[model samples]
Target: MFNGLSAFPLTPMNETGVDEQAFTRLVENLVLANVSSIGALGSTGSYAYLSRTERQRVAQIAVECAGEIPVMVSIGAVRTRDVLDLAEDAQQVGVKALLLPPMSYQKLTDEDVYSLYQAVTSNISVPLCVYDNPGTTHFEFNDELHGRIAHLPWVGSIKIPGVSVVPDEAKARVDRLRAVIPKHVTIGVSGDTLAATGLNAGCEAWYSVMGGLFPNTAKIMTDTALTGNAAEATRLSRRLEPLWALFRDCGGSLRVIATAAELRQFTTTPSLPLPLRTFTGETRQRIAAVIDELELS
Candidate 1:
């Protein structure tokens, strides 16, 4: 299922087209790291920047490479038709699940979000995971909104990013959600720092972009934490903190993945979409020091 450490890999592209070779390599590395699952076309994958056909091709390749491992396709577009189309494409390619965010760049009421989920569920057969990423989607989904949406039969999980934007707001929100959300439906915390706390508080899984950098380390941390081995988990978590910090101190998911790739040598070019720079020289130097200090590579 999606209820574990899901490594969201960056969708690799080069001058030719969607780089299937790199995509294959990334998937192979993640499976070897013992990741519970993989999500293609995620925030780290630059989902928004990819073309419709490219997204479909990447999804197919992910499924092919994963073989038995589950593959989650992040499908959220402006038009409901487009979303359905992508979902159908993914389902055809044997994707295990779909992760959808609310419509972006527009104001959507609770009803609007619900309707989108309903439309997706009615058409798509696989499980649907709703991502409540207000940081990017700009739609702050409170408990009531999420509760209503979760009632839909196909809804599987909710991905929430916990950060202290307001006074103790993140923890408060997590508490409320853990109380209200049905125990059957899983809640996955997105931030690395909050994973342990969220799991202790009721989060079933952690959707980690940081995991791509140090998947083996993350595997050790999550496995230990899940089993109540706090001391060992904390030790691994602290060891991973430096790499995580480098990613946190960045523009978005792409910057984080690029920085990690720079250290891990996952790809030759750690390029991000336009308007986002390739990280500063000072940041790069600091990241190198952190990687060397921690021996991340």
Candidate 2:
């Protein structure tokens, strides 16, 4: 379950609250696409912006819709107590795993993060994936710190950030970390644009935001790479470079994906949470143009 494409869907919302119907459609689509697993309430899902009640509801919805497909729910919160509470909530809904990042207001030391993982892993019922998304949480995980956390029981995977795009460098990066962490714990790649590079470099999984939006496209690239056809996988990924460029120009993936989701009718327009606006005017036009040019559905 942790070894292949893990698609993370956006948690759709409207003026009222969680858009249960649309969220359901997203999860069902992933199930149909036959993704390796579904990661709910991930950064892609806007977990940090939601209230605890909303997060729990989303977790229940994901697991209920996923059926036999593994569901990994994010349990990252500001406080350890709330993270534990979320872990219990997710497990209660039968989520196969949990995704956690060291969310903190103050700068966290290596000891702080290691201890955080130790506390959460102590009583968790399912496997946990360490979400090392430095872009949002602002807490970076060094290889040594990841090794320390991976030593804890139930720490089954580490979701590292993007590696160098160059194949050899990317492989070296994965190999370096592979040496430090326990052999049983898998290393997954996060950055969507770098996924082909990461996986071709021998990373075990692709924890992908784009995969959530377009699972078939992701499945094709992932399948091709895993089969040892690196050139075709790189070709497939390069084909989406325009979409990735939009992500860079339009201020990260959240809004750009929200736009794509809206265009694709997977969610209502303006699906993002409060204060975070979706793209508009020229930017939206460009996104739509790229979508058409790439024949993205």
What is the C-alpha lDDT profile of model 1 across 1-297, one tens digit per residue?
A: 867688888766654566677778888888888788887888778778778898989899899888778999999887788899889888988999999998656799888888898888888788888888877788888888888778787788888886443325655766687676666678887877656656545566778776755677666667777787766765676676776677577645567567656556666564455554456578877866877787652
TM-score of each: 0.91, 0.98
Best by TM-score: 2
RMSD (CA, Å), each prediction: 2.5, 0.9
Question: Candidate 2 — number of clashing residue pairs?
Answer: 0
Go through the candidates in order and give each one's C-alpha lDDT.
0.76, 0.91
Per-residue lDDT of model 2, residues 166-191, tens digit only? 89999999999999889999999989
Which pairs, if any, clash in model 1?
A: none
For residue 21, what is the lDDT in candidate 2? 92
